[model samples]
Target: MVKDLYPSRVNETSQIVRRQDPVIHNENARTEGPLSAEEIDFYEENGYILLKSFFQGEELQKLKQELDSTMEDHQHKEGPDIIKEPSSNEIRSIFEVHKDKSYFENLSKDERLVSIMEQILGSQVYINQSRINFKPGFKGKEFYWHSDFETWHVEDGMPRMRALSCSIVLTDNYEYNGPLMLVPGSHKWYVQTAGETPDNNFESSLQKQEVGVPDEDSMRWLVDQAGGRIDRATGPAGSVLLFESNTMHGSAGNISPYPRSNVFFVYNSIENKLEQPFSGKEPRPEFLANRENIQPIQPVSNKSTARS
Candidate 1:
């Protein structure tokens, strides 16, 4: 359901696109599984994997134009998931794009990503969420260090930690540009926090990435136990990172002159899917927790080039 895009050049369109299937076939890259055994091993042991120059040329360009439209449309609006920082036009995220737009929807369904999911989770995997996290220049807010699974498990009924966060860099990420920071191998230790989870809402989720911010002492202890090796993943625009959902990760506020943006997708195993919400209440909004469209993704080819 995308329009007027083919990978390069800035094209403008006012269209709400949809798609029938996910496409992994790339002209510049082969359709076979992209990750190596060593990479998989690293992801398993270190809790994250960063692949530089993962996608480029027309694909990146087309996605950027689509994001350009999204950023413009949702900057200060109120609807679905278009979340902005507390009192400003600076956006925090545009959630569940795969449900509405074709460009993001196709990328989320790409075979390259799903094949990796097949390796990590299983053959039957569906996306839990999809959104572009906007870390705008100068004024982007910070995300506290916490495990995503904590909130997913406690609030959204996710049963276990069998999920992963795959983030594709949209803008060049640098040390000074609010790069995502990860405490290596921190997923092994599930830290229990003292703080309470805020109510389920876009604002709450934006203000607090973690369900509960583990106290400083708790976070310090967890870091010490995890070997105290923190890694800030900084790379070019096309870099792709796959991180364990349980890994303790966060990013500082962006003070750089250029924006740091990424399209993030969370994939959860069908078998390790969410149980009922802990509150015994109805599940969260579909944009927040997608449990109904549990169908496994099927890989498709790019019927036409991404460029027009």
Candidate 2:
């Protein structure tokens, strides 16, 4: 049985537990990767780093096309993997995308992405989850503030905070368009929310999270720890935001004319494979968390190599 170092959603009162795991496991003794020493340091301090224009021109265009085409392919389909908006049929998110043999799968194994994931994880890694999230203009809804690690630990049996997410912006992330926002340095502490895990929580949680989210007091406390500031990741198309798993993040509703969309990937170290749920319930569906076929990604040498 895996020992639960970070316990959450078990107590009546929310507790602030100090993080036991390092934010960047392979901080030192690393050789080659895309991140500079300074950039790595920034990620260590802020719990996130934005790479502006990480994909551009041809690369960006191809990703956009693939995103549009994938959405079209799923338009008539319905499954546990596809989540729709609360009010309309507009798709909110499509999960487990890396499982498909599509452009997204290729992007997942691109050396540029895999190398950085390997460096931070200090070992071989595999996709914990992958999705293309969409927030359409006028109807886009808000995502409440919460720590992903809190949910993954209690519901999905993630043992530690050795995972991270990369959100590749597919459209201009304007301030008003519900771009990702996070409390800097929030990853240093784990906020134990007050709740018991509901059976099949992800079914409704994906539409509008009610149980695992941090309450108002906890949110204030987390922001205060970061000097009472919330940072928004507003950037042009092709920008990428890499954030730690425990980082408290969410986005506002998009009432602007432009829609917001991104291809998001979660990578977990092979050493931190999930165990039985800490919630004492059955694990979430395979579409939400993968325990089977957890294969390490083989990084390609270049974009052309990924194509091959």
Best candidate, TM-score: 2
Global CA lDDT computed for model 1:
0.71
**TM-score of model 1 relative to the true fold?**
0.83
Q: Evaluated with lDDT, which candidate comes out highest? A: 2
Q: Residue-pair clashes per candidate, as listed?
A: 7, 0
Residue 151, candidate 2: C-alpha displacement in angstroms? 0.6
In the range 1-308, model 1's lDDT, one tens digit per residue, is 11211111112211112211122112222223466656766776678888997878888877788888888877667876777666765777888987764778888888777877877764457889999877779887687897777667666777666788999998888889889999887776665544344455434565665444555775777678667878999998988998987788988888779888788899887776666765344677888889885887785455255644
Q: What's the TM-score of each model vs. the native?
A: 0.83, 0.97
| lDDT score for residue 165 of model 1 | 91
Which residue runs does candidate 2 get wrong by more than 4 Å? 27-31, 305-308
Kindly list the per-residue Cα lDDT of model 2 for residues 1-308, writing each as its tens digit.
88888787888888887899998888461455668888888888999999999988888888999888888889888999998765667777899888788578888888899889888888899999999987789867888998999999999999999999999999998888888899999999999889888899988898889888888888899899999899999999999999999999998888898998899999999999889889889999998998997878898655664244
TM-score of 2: 0.97
lDDT of 2: 0.88
